[model samples]
Target: MNFKVVPFKALTPQQLYTIYHLRVTVFVVEQTCAYQEVDDLDLTAEHLLGVDTDGRLMAYARLMQEPNQQARIGRVLVNPADRGHGYGQLLVQTAIEQIQQLWPETTQIKIQAQHYLDQFYQSFGFKPVSSVYLEDDIPHQDMILTL
Candidate 1:
């Protein structure tokens, strides 16, 4: 898989479309969630796209700068057909590395992750910082990784 990390303004039209399409595919259509998928935060966040040699977008995530010189990673997804191939893990690990390069002063990274993936994020050094809660009717918990 090849990874590309760029700001919203820098994303090509096709790249932008692919990102949203994949997010909606996994987060909304595939999961059967009906909430709004195109939130306004995308304009200020850096997007990471994981593409295959065949030019298919297999994974994605967005990193946003938060208050107190911290960063947040969200909208993480791996193509349904690509799951179990380690693309999700690769996507996140690459996001963290890119975040560090983009914001060297950042001291921490946060994620509002699906509850079932708590252990997955935990393996990447993220520790739960909030109790389980419902967001968009899906169980989630806030996790943090201090840099």
Candidate 2:
């Protein structure tokens, strides 16, 4: 899979449409969770799109600088049809690398990860910083990686 890091303003209409589609399909429709998926963050966050050779969006994530002097990665997802391939892994590693490049002085990264993926995030050196809490009725925990 090829990955493209595009800021919100740089994303084309079709790309935006596909991103919203994939995110909704997995986070809402498939998970049966109802909440606001689209938000103000999309306006400032840089987007990571993992696309396949056939030009389909295989995975996606977002990187943004936060007010608390931390870089954040969020809205992470792998396309349902594209799951078993480690695209999520690549997506996250790429997000970290991009954060480093885009904000060199930043030394910490944060994620409000789904609770079930604790081990996965742990593998990347993120440790739980908050107790698991319900967000949109789904369990989530804040994890942080101190770089």
What are the per-residue Cα lDDT tens digits for candidate 1 across 2-117?
99888999999998898988888999988889988999999999998888898799889999999898999999998998899888889889999999999999999999999999
**TM-score of each candidate structure, all chains considered together:** 0.96, 0.96
- Predicted structure 1: lDDT: 0.92
Model 2: how far is 31 from its true place, Å? 1.1
* lDDT of every model, 2 decimals: 0.92, 0.92
lDDT tens digits, residue span 1-147, model 2: 998889999999999999999989998999898989899999999998999898799999989998666899999999999889888888899999999998888889999999999999999999999999999888999999999
Error of 2 at 85 (Å): 1.2
Q: Per-residue error at 129 for model 1, in Å?
A: 0.8
